[model samples]
Target: LGSVLLLLALYVLQGVPLGLAGSVPLILQSRSASYTEQAFFSLVFWPFSLKLLWAPLVDAVYVRRFGRRKSWLVPTQYVLGLFMIGLSRRVDALLGDGQGRGPDVVALTATFFLFEFLAATQDIAVDGWALTMLSRENVGYASTCNSVGQTAGYFLGNVLFLALESPSFCNKYLRFQPQPRGIVTLSDFLFFWGAVFLITTTLVALLKKENKELTPTKEETKGITDTYKLLFSIIKMPAVLTFCLLILTAKVGFSAADAVTGLKLVEEGVPKEHLALLAVPMVPVQIILPLIISKYTAGPQPLNTFYKAMPFRLLFGLEFAFLVWWTPKVKHEGGFPVYYYVVVLLSYALHQVTLYSMYVAIMAFNAKVSDPLIGGTYMTLLNTVSNLGGNWPSTVALWLVDPLTVKECVGAQEQACGTAAAAELCTKAGGSCVTTLDGYYVESVVCVILGFAWWFLFGPKLKKLQDEGQSSWKCKRTN
Candidate 1:
């Protein structure tokens, strides 16, 4: 019970920063360009995909007296708290008001990038600690703790914060008296969580002691060089290399629907707070779906679940495009109709089901195929590939949205307004840059087409790899 609680707490802390980062793009949706918002997100999230590069150092180097995990975890948490508190001071200026003032994307990106880097380091330590913290029989619970804690933390940081920060939401739901703004601001939320991080980490440091028996000995722990060598050797295996390629390319199909849809909704006049609230129902679904999916994923061909889930997820990209196109039509003078919200909720729920199924399936496949001799490192490598698969595609989709979208200035001059400056000039010259084409829709069509192509091309190969003998994936150790 204690072990579970500790792991949950650590993972929750790790997740809050991620949730906070996720919320920023939504908050800035109106103030910044779509590409800018995604660029910020992509930069902040890069550490997660790239953390495997430094995972070896995190494992191999630690102060014996301070405890291996704590050596990194304690200082990392402290720095994270300090960074958050510092960011809270400038967040208002960084975000800017939804009016004329624009966000300082460069500063926001730099600040959050460092913050996420710390959070990623903490993740490495907590993940390492979870193994030793539990009995071998109960070690399986670590992933469960991770999934639940991170989801809950993400909810609190993103959904709850966004809802509470909206004056309209607070007025309608929680407040007895009307106010100009929501009960809490972004600054206050950051400061409060930063303090919580500091306090909780301090308590863990002083009260909880690391068990000496659980600590890795000099013989057991690999040096950084050995760890990297092992990682490369694992990559060198034909089967593992093929699998890595599969992991890295898998999410291109789902990227637009998964990464850009919500932001695009906000762009199309959906209220940010309402969109955040829309995710409230999804929190439990996100937490519970993995558990349910794990059952199906435990079979020999876990990738089968992934394969089945792909087309549905890709299909939802079209559904999402249709929903965004329909949103403005359903919106009355007052607000969106009840039926519209219902349709959106239902659609999003279905999408989440497919998403989690794929996620759990891939993770299960990774566990099943991993080389137990270098279990942790091997799993980390595969997970890194999986994360990168999602990250890079989302980034590319976001980057291409502006370029693919078509707009024209409608007035006396009748010129193309391809850039923001051109749009501004059009506005100044008694003209409007009306969007004749939405990049999101264009991107959605291309993504779905690409998704189906990849599916047909790679589906057979995935099944073949899944059936390959285990010896093909195992790497021989070097002296």
Candidate 2:
């Protein structure tokens, strides 16, 4: 229960920025209330998504210092809690004077990014511990609990909380007339989430559970010099490289497709209020998707089953289909035209179902192939690569969102950015936004193409590796 709650809290906090930024453009902001503004808000996601970069550190340093689960959890929970409270206070300052977009977005997103990093680091520990602590017999059951918690967190975090227009801020900004300030700023309503995480951490600290009997002792600990050292050694292992490469490539295209689909809603002029409706499908997703994915396995299966599962094959087709089919309408009428959000949600739901199913299938397969005694480290290596997978799209997306310079947009502002900040920045300055949108589209298309290409190029090797992953470990077989 503690682990599940802790995971819930972490997942809940993860959506704070999404809810906040989605609501931002509608607020009485100086910037154009355009899709361009939404793109700016999207920039906040890079930090959270790129968390794969420092994942090894979570295992090597953060976990090593305090213990895998606790190190990341303790400081992260407190910081997120305190930081959110600070934001609530900061809002009094920003909205107090009605601060500029430059100063305001920067301040909020910086703290947001830091909190995301903490959240990301903590995820590694949480996920790792999930793998380690649950007796092999109970893993499928434990995964069900974790998924439920995580799904609830996303729905509550993004849907329920974000959808509520800040009455207080509205009451203040718009006066007694009750002009709704569509959504609050990044620092707006996160204090509640801070409480959630703080409570989770407190509960986790209080819970007493069985420890890993197989975990190595003092002298074994002395072997790890640092996070980076541990990270490098892990990556260098033979199948580990194969895992990392596969990991890095696997998600990039799919994520790009996913990102654009959401952007399509905003770009097509769908309201954040409409986006709130997207959370509805998450109910089924929370309840059914994980189980659907786990259905094929019984104490792990053969790699041939993985190959037959068509993990990559199905994802390739579904992603492409999702991107093409879920086109968003620009505006709404008497009744809500939240259809775009709904379709997109379904797309995402299916995408996640396939992705998790494939991911677990692969993991079980890897467990079968690798020496069972080294499960902890090999699993850690898989994580490191998964982190790498997360990084590529984030860096690309950030670049796309950052906007080119004022010079490139309309005239020269001299003070703005270069390609280094993301050429998309130029388009964000008002006149050039469409051009940036084109760039984002192009990037997504490129990612999709790459995914297809990867499917063809790496297909055979992945088939072999996945096949090996299915073969039961001697240890697992005995059990």
Candidate 3:
């Protein structure tokens, strides 16, 4: 429990930046950011999408005195906290002050990139710590901490932060007019969270003790080349190769659909507050569903569980489009009905269960097949490949949304036509610009088709390869 708590704190600090990143689209949309600008901001998360590049540094370097993972973990937290403090001072200027004073989006994105880089580094260190600290018996518990704690941290970073900044909370408690400024601005929240991070860092350093079951042998410490060779050797295996390919293509359809839906929701005038509110109920769902998945996937047929879950995962991608299509029916001349929020909340819960089930199942499979000889490197490589598959497609989808959307701006406020510069260009050209999601719909349809093909074509083959690999490894171990 102490280890879980420490990991939870570490994940929460990492999540704060992620949450802030989630808020950027809506916050900047109010100030008239274009789809491209918002997409660029989203792209700043590239660090996380590509952290495999620097993951080796965490493994390679550490102080002998403080502890291997701890040395990296403690200092990274302090650096992240400091970055937050610095970011609070600059964010308003970067995101712009709402009176037509345009902020430097490039500069702001650079700061956010730095923040994400640190957070990604922290993730590497935390993962290393978890690998080293958890025992074979407690490995399942560590996975639980990872899913629940990390999701909780992300909720605090993304949903809770938005809720705090919403008009409803401000109006009720802060006695402010019903406006989105709420009681605390984004900068103030950053400053407070920065302090919280430092405090948590101190507690983790003091309380957690490193597990000493595995010591790094000379072979393990040979060089970075050995790690690479070990990783490559695993990839050369037929089962591991198929696993990588499956992970690479599996989520592209779903990721592409999810990318554009959030932007569409923002365009439909749903407040960040409402989205955050709906997300609140999903947090426990996020934590609980993974536990349920862990329980069911604990059996020998975990691969079978994944195969069964894949269809539900693919179907959930279509749900976002269906929800968007049905929005008008639910709203129907009145404001959004309570029923709409309830439906969204329920859908989100279902999404969590389906998505996390597949995720935990994959993690279990990776764990099962991994060679203890390579320590954490084998699983990390698999995870890195899996993330690349999801992230790059999502990045491409962001750019696609811009071209697909039709823009309109005539007699509209400067902040109303997506961006101030776009408004200027549209008004000067004497043509109204209106944006539409025709492209997203097309892309989503294609994604769904691709999802079906990937499942039917490759799913069984990959499972057979996995079964063969696991059986081979067990025989080798017993000999």
lDDT of each: 0.87, 0.53, 0.73
* Candidate 2 lDDT score relative to the true structure: 0.53
Candidate 2 per-residue lDDT, tens place, 1-479, comes to 55455444555555454445444443423223323434454455565445555665565554444465676667777777776676766654543344433435545456556656666666666665665555556666555655555555556656655455544434644565765354554454677666766776776666734354634453245334444454456566566677568767766656555444454444444445455655685676656754665567535453344444444534544454444434432334543355644655666666666566666676665555555554455555565556557556644653554342132445424323344343355545433422323444555556667766766677567666644433232222211
Task: Identify the leading candidate in terms of lDDT.
Answer: 1
Compare the candidates by TM-score and give the number of the best one: 1
**Top-down TM-score ranking:** 1, 3, 2
Model 3 spans with C-alpha error above 4 angstroms:
1-5, 101-103, 131-141, 172-180, 202-222, 299-301, 328-334, 407-425, 429-431, 435-437, 471-479
Candidate 1: stretches off by over 4 Å = 135-138, 218-220
Rank all candidate structures by their lDDT, best first, as comma-separated numbers: 1, 3, 2
lDDT of 1: 0.87
Q: Judging by lDDT, tell me the better candidate of 1 and 2.
A: 1
lDDT of 3: 0.73
TM-score quality measure for candidate 1: 0.96
lDDT tens per residue, model 3, 255-349:
65667776666666666677767877666676577677888788765777777888887787788878777775666554588888888888877
Candidate 2 has its poorest 10 consecutive residues by lDDT at 470-479
Query: Considering lDDT, which of the candidate structures 1 and 3 is the better prediction for this target?
Result: 1
Q: All candidates: CA RMSD in angstroms?
A: 1.6, 7.2, 4.3
